[model samples]
Target: MTELLLVGIGTGNPDHITLEGRKALQGADLILIPRKGPEKSDLAELRRRIVLQSVRDGMDRVVEFDLPVRDPDLPYLEAVERWHDAIAELWAVTLAAHPDAHSAALLVWGDPSLYDSTLRIAARLDPTPKVRVIPGITALQALTAAHAIPLNTLAGSVEITTGRRLRDTGWPDGAETVAVMLDGACAFETLDPDGLQIWWGAYLGMDEQILSAGPLEEAAPHIMRIRAEARDRHGWIMDTYLLRRTGVPG
Candidate 1:
């Protein structure tokens, strides 16, 4: 049986990769890195660099593959399924290319448990490989660490959600703080800015990282402008933020 390992490398920082992830990288017989074209070449390049750093024998074992684009015209769930199927098919082809290898690893962004689909896609492999995950620092952890802020205040609960959900439904019930991800649109602007605090970061943990925080009312506009400018400059952006209800720790 082929053994599949998913290693979380964390945001874009080399230091963010955990010892466990490093060990997994070193142990793998094959490492598959996905390339998302030139626009996101940095993503693939970072993984390649990390592997080189972690495993002395990594370059020969590494396989770079193209990622399938989800057709934007299809319904959301349908598009995801089609995209995932294509990826799984590619995974099988890539695996077959190295018949002698029993163990393979993929470099995942953030902890595999949070907002990542590597595991889900792995399930689609026929006679699925025995899968293992090495957790890395999540975007949430990196964001909070970069800003020197606590994830939550004194036992207060936080809701983790996506940008689509934030825009569809305002703040969730019992959510003292909301950590929003996959929100390229900056959905936080839709909510009433009164009595809210927002901590925002783009490209967290990278050399080009940018951070902003304060009362949501005053900071939202500034965050929007900066976010747009950064995305335009870089051609892509990955951002996450935490919005907390002011004085609601009681």
Candidate 2:
């Protein structure tokens, strides 16, 4: 039976790879890396660097596969389901091609347990494969670390949500600290921002990282402009943010 290792490699920093993740890379018979077109070429190159550094000799089989793009015509969730199925098929084909790949490693961005769906996709394999998950730094942690702020207020709760949820739900009923990830729509604007503070980071822990924070009212415009410029420059952006309603009960 093939053992599938979903290894989290952190945001974009090579150093973010944990010691256990490194060991998993070395132990793997083959490493599967995804290429997300030329616009996101840097992502693939970063994975390449990690694999090159982790594999010195003896075990030198790292394969790259083009990731399937989600169809925009279908509803978001449905498209994602179809995309994951295709990705699982790709993984199965790749694993079949490498007979010696007893333990295959898939380099996942951020922690697989977070907003990422790699683990869900892996479950779609025809024959359920044994799984090993190696955790790494998540984008939320990286965002907070880059901004030098704690994710949650003193003994306060933090709500992890997406841009879509924030837009739909306005503000959560009880949570004071909200960390939003995978927010392409810039949902921060939907909030009142009267007493809210926001810490936003893009391409966190990388050379092109942009961090901005202040009273949400004041900093919102700047973050919007910066996020737009960064996305334009890089053709893609991965960002996470922390929002706290000031003066709210903890």
Candidate 3:
């Protein structure tokens, strides 16, 4: 019975790791770290650092495997399904190499419950392993904390959505605030920006973090420039932002 622990490492900051997550890392028999190509190798490196600094070394083995790349030609959902299947096959193969290990762990980027695919991929394993999720700080928390702003207004509801959805749907009904994630494009530009105030942050908890806030109209261009410049400098960037409609009642 392999116990698969998905430990959340939090948005690129090792200090954001929770005590429970640290304990899970220590308890694992093997830890699988995925290498996402040279451009994103820093991601894998972060997990490596976490395992090195936290995991009790005695009998625990840390294994690094190359992650499967998704085909861009396929439709979004189809490509995702194929990608997950490939990853599951990769995982099975990785696990087979270390047949003696009964328990394995993977360090997730943020709280696995929020927008991460590890849990979904874990479900695809054969004779499925018992899954345990240890939570960590989320990008949303990092964004709000960095700006020192409340995610919601007085008694106002927040709609957590992706950049694509926001771009397609314009603005959601009922919710006074919309927090956007996985937005490579500055989708907020599609909105009227008449009464919306946006708080944007990139590399949320990392050393090169950037924070910007103001009325969407005034701040949108600045965020776009900053995001582009940061990406140019770092070769990659992870960002999230919150958009609030001004004058919305509680």
Candidate 2 wrongly placed segments (more than 4 Å): 248-250
> TM-score: which candidate is best?
1
TM-score per candidate, in order?
0.98, 0.96, 0.96
Candidate 1, superposed: residue stretches over 4 Å from native = none
Candidate 2 residue-wise lDDT, 49-99, digit = tens = 888877785136788889899999999889989999999998889888887
Stronger candidate by lDDT (1 vs 3) = 1
Q: Which stretches of candidate 3 lie over 4 Å from their true place?
A: 58-60
Cα RMSD for candidates in order: 1.1, 1.4, 1.4
lDDT value for candidate 2?
0.89
lDDT of each: 0.92, 0.89, 0.89
**lDDT, model 2, position 95:** 86
lDDT of 3 by residue, 1-250 (tens): 3899999888988898998988888888888889999988889888888887787592258888899999999998899999999999899899988888888989999789998899999999997999999988999999999999888888878899999898989899876899999998989999998999999998878888899999999999999998999898888899999999888763
